[model samples]
Target: MTGGATVTGEGRTREPRDAVRARLVDVAVHLLRDRGPDAVTTRAVAAAAGVQAPTIYRLFGDKDGLLDAVAERAADDFVAAKAQAARAEAHRGADPVKDLRAAFWAQVEFGVANPEVFRLLGDPARVLRSGAAQAGRAVLQARVHRVALTGRLRVPEGRCVDMVQSAGTGVVQTLLATPVPDRDPHLVGAMWDALVAAVLVDGAGSADGSGAAEPTASATFVAFRALAPQLPGLTGAERALLVDWLARAETAAVQD
Candidate 1:
C-alpha cells in the first residue's frame, strides 16, 4: 500500500477496479477544487489516490480523458437531480414557462456552485463528444417539447433550446466574472423574462391549431417536427421519414 505497492492474489488487486478508479477521480476532484485545474496533474492524482501513475493512464487513457470522466461524472449527477425534480414537477402539471424558468435558475446555481466542473463541461469539444452532454440536452429538449405541446412555444423548439442554453451560459459567466458583492441580483430574473418573451406567444396555443396559435403554418410544422424524434413505437427509419415530411411541410408552409 506504500507508494502503490500491490497487495493481491496472483497479480490481481485486492480492491475492485471500479473502486480504485473512483478513488482517483475523487482525488482529482479535490485537487481541482482546492488547488485549481493546474494542480490536478496525473502524478499528483495518482499519488493522492494511492495508485501508480500507469493506473491512471490505464483507467482513463490520459489527463484529458481523466478530466472528461470527472466532468461527465459531475454532470451526470447534476442532470439526474434536475431530471428527477422535473419529473416530480411534471406529475404536478407545472406550467411550462414556469418550469423552464425554474430550470434556468438551477443551471445558474450549478454553474456558480461548481465553477471548475462547469467550465470543463463548457468546452466545445467536450460538449460535442460527451454522452453526459447529450443526456443534459435530452432533458432540456423534453422540457421544451412540453412547452410546444402546450402551444406556448412561438419559435422552433430547437431555437428556443439554443436561446435558453446560450443565455444561461452567458449570464452565469458574467456573474462569475463580477466580484460576489458587485454581481447584479436582478440579472437572472431579467434575462429569463426577456428570453421567455422572445420565445413564447402571448397566449397559449394557436387559434387555428396549426402552430402554438400563431398565424404562421411554418410554426406549427416546426413544433410538430421537434416532437417527431420522441414518437414511441417508431423505428429509426420511420422517425427519419416523419422528420423529412415535416421539413417539407415546413418549407411549403413558409413559401405560402
Candidate 2:
C-alpha cells in the first residue's frame, strides 16, 4: 500500500521502513558513483528505487539529507575496510610498515575512485564534526602506533600522524585534480617512497657506514611518549606528568 512494500501472494506484506531507506540510499550511491553528484536528484533516486517521489522527502527531509546519508554510508564502508585490513595485519604479525603502505594505497585508491564520496567527506568543518572522520583517523593512528612500536618511527606519534594524514590527503587531491592524460603512473609509489624515507628509520640504526644514525635522545623521547601509559614503577600522577612533559618536548622539537 506504500512505497518499498512488496506484494506477497494474497498477503500484501510490507517491507520495513528502514529497508526502504536503505534501498533509497543504495540507489543514490549508485547514481552518485555512476553519474556524478548531479545525477543524484530526488526524482532520479526515487524513480530508480521504485518509490514515490514524496517518499524521498518523507524519509530523508530533502536532497541534502539524502546526500548526507550517502556520505555516511560511504564513510562507514571505507572505515570498516581499513579497520579490517588493520586487524588482519595485526593477527598475522605482519610488518606494520607493510600494512601501512597497503592501507595508504587503499586510501589513495578510494579517494580517487570515489570522488563524490571523497568530496562529501573532505570538508574541514565536516571532518571536525563527523564521527566517521574520527573513526578513520583512529584507524590511521593505530597503524602509525604499530610502526612507532617497532622503534623505527622518526618523529613523535602525533607529528607522524599529522604528517601522514596531510600527505595522504595531498596525494589524493593532487592525483584527482590532475588530468587523466597527464597523470603519472609512478606518482603513488614515489609518494610512498618519499613518505617512508622520512617517517621510518631504514638500514641499520647505526653509524658504521650506514646513512642512518643511532637512536638519539629525541628518539628515546618519542619511544617513551608512545609507551608512556604502560611503563611500570611510576605512579599514575607521575606517568601523567611525564606524558605531558614529553608531549611539550615533542612539540618544541618539531618547532625547533
Candidate 3:
C-alpha cells in the first residue's frame, strides 16, 4: 500500500484496511484495463471501490504510489502463475529446454491476453522505482547465469544470456504493439523458433556461414534460442522483471 493517512478520531470508520485496499486495487486494475493507465485516479478508484478518496490517498501515498502498488500486485500474481505452471510442467517430465520455451511463450501469451495488467507491470518509470521490479530483474539474471553455468545452454561468459534477454524483449514487445486481430500465431511462433535456432547453433558465422555478418533479426533469434533452455531456472520475480522489460521495450518501439 502506498498512501496511509493518520486518523484524529478515536472511532474512525471500521472498514478493514486490507479489504479496502484490495477493493481499490481491483478498481484501479479495472479502470486501467478498460480506460488505460491515465484513466486511473484517486477519485475514480475511490468511487469505484466505494471508499473515500482520502482513504485511497492514505492507503497509497499518491497516484504514482497507487500505480506502484498495483504493479506490485500484478507482479506477485504473474510470479505465482509462472511458478504453478512450471511445477505442473516439471511434473510432466518436461525437458528443461522445452520447459523454458513454454514459460517464455506463456509470458508472452499472458501479456497479450491481459494487456492492462501487462501495461501496469511493464511501465518503465513505475517498474524502475519499485522493489518488485528490482527483485524480478535479479531473479531473471540469476536464472540465466545458473543455466549457463550448468551448461544447459551454450551461454558464453554470460554474454549469450544478455543477448537472449534482449532478443526476448524485442520479440514480446513486437507482439504487444501489433494489433491483436491482425496478429498471426504462426508468425509469432516462427519468430520464437527463429530466435531459438539462432542462439542454439554454435557458430560465430552467420546463418549462411558467411563471414562475421551484421546482426539481423534472424541473428537475434539465434542468440535467444541458444539461451532459452536456461530461462526456466529464473525465479518468478525475475521472470516478471524480464516480462516488464519486454513490455517496456514494446511500448518504446510503438512510440518510435
Candidate 4:
C-alpha cells in the first residue's frame, strides 16, 4: 500500500499520509458539528476530503474508527488549551485553587462552545478508555493531588476527582439541555462552588466555602472506593463486588 498520496481539497493538495488522514478527520468533525453525526457518512467525508472511499477505510478502518479519531482530535485540542492555561497560571504564580477554578472554567467554556464534540465525550466508559481522555484526567488528577498535598481536600484524592468530574459534566450537560437563550449563565459558577464546597475544607482550596456541603460519610466512602483496588485477600469477584458497593456508596454520599 502507498504510504503517501496526493489528496486535493479546497484547491490544495495534501501529500503525506498523515496529512490526508488529518484532512478527513477535520472534514468529519466539521460535518459532525454543523450537520450532526448523521451527516458524517463515509461518502460525505470522502467527498469533503477529496479522497476515495477506500482511503478512509485504509486510514481509519471504518466509520466508527473515523469517529474515534475525530473524538481524539477534539479531546487533544481541549487538553492542549487547558494545558496552556495551566502553564500560564503557573507562570503568573496563581493559587492552586484558582488554577483549578480557571481550568474548570476553561472546560465549561470548551464544552459549551463545542456541544457536539462534548456529547461524544460525555460517555464515561469512552473517556475512561481513550488515551486523550486519560491525558485530560491526568491533568485533573494532578490538580486535585496538589489540593490534597495542601491538606485542604476534605475527601480522599479519588473522591475529590470523581466529584469534580461529576459536577463539571453535570453542569455542562444541564446547560446544553436548555435552549441557548434560556440557559442560565450563572449555573457553571454555582456548580463549581458546590463542587468545591463538597470536597474541600473550610477556607481551604476553595475561594468561597467551608467543609463539605454534605457530611463526611460520602467522602469516607469515596476514600474507600479509592482503596478498593489495593485491598488484599479478596478474590477477583469479591473485589469487583466491593468496588460496585463503593460506587453505590459514592452515589449515596452526594445525596447526603
TM-score per candidate, in order? Answer: 0.80, 0.85, 0.64, 0.74
Better of 1 and 4 by lDDT: 1
* 128-187: candidate 3 lDDT, tens digit per residue: 777765654554454444333333333342454555455555666777888878776776
Q: Give the clashing pairs for model 2.
A: none
Q: Which model scores highest in TM-score? A: 2
Least well predicted 10-residue stretch by lDDT in candidate 3: 203-212
For candidate 1, the lDDT comes to 0.82
lDDT of 4 by residue, 43-135 (tens): 999998998999999999999889888899999988887777766766786666767877788788888888889988886666866899988
Expressed as tens digits, the lDDT of each residue in 26-49 for candidate 1 is 998888878889999999999999
Q: How many residue pairs clash in all the candidates, one count each?
A: 5, 0, 17, 0
What ranges in model 2 sit over 4 Å off? 1-12, 202-214
CA-lDDT, candidates in order: 0.82, 0.82, 0.62, 0.78
How many times do residue backbones clash in model 1?
5
Clashes of 4: 0
Clashing pairs for model 1 are 205-212, 205-213, 206-212, 206-213, 207-213
Q: Can you write out model 2's per-residue Cα lDDT over 1-256, one digit (the tens) per residue? A: 5575777888878787899999999999999999999999999999999989999999999998898888888998999988998898999998777778778888889999998889888878667767888999999999888877766677888777887787778888998899989888888888877886677666422223244435645555666788988899999999999999988886665455
Q: Give the TM-score comparing model 1 with the true structure, all chains together.
A: 0.80
Query: In model 3, which runs have C-alpha deviations exceeding 4 angstroms?
Result: 1-13, 90-93, 134-152, 156-164, 201-256
Superposed by TM-score, candidate 1 places the C-alpha of residue 232 at a distance from the truth, in angstroms, of 12
Better of 2 and 3 by TM-score: 2
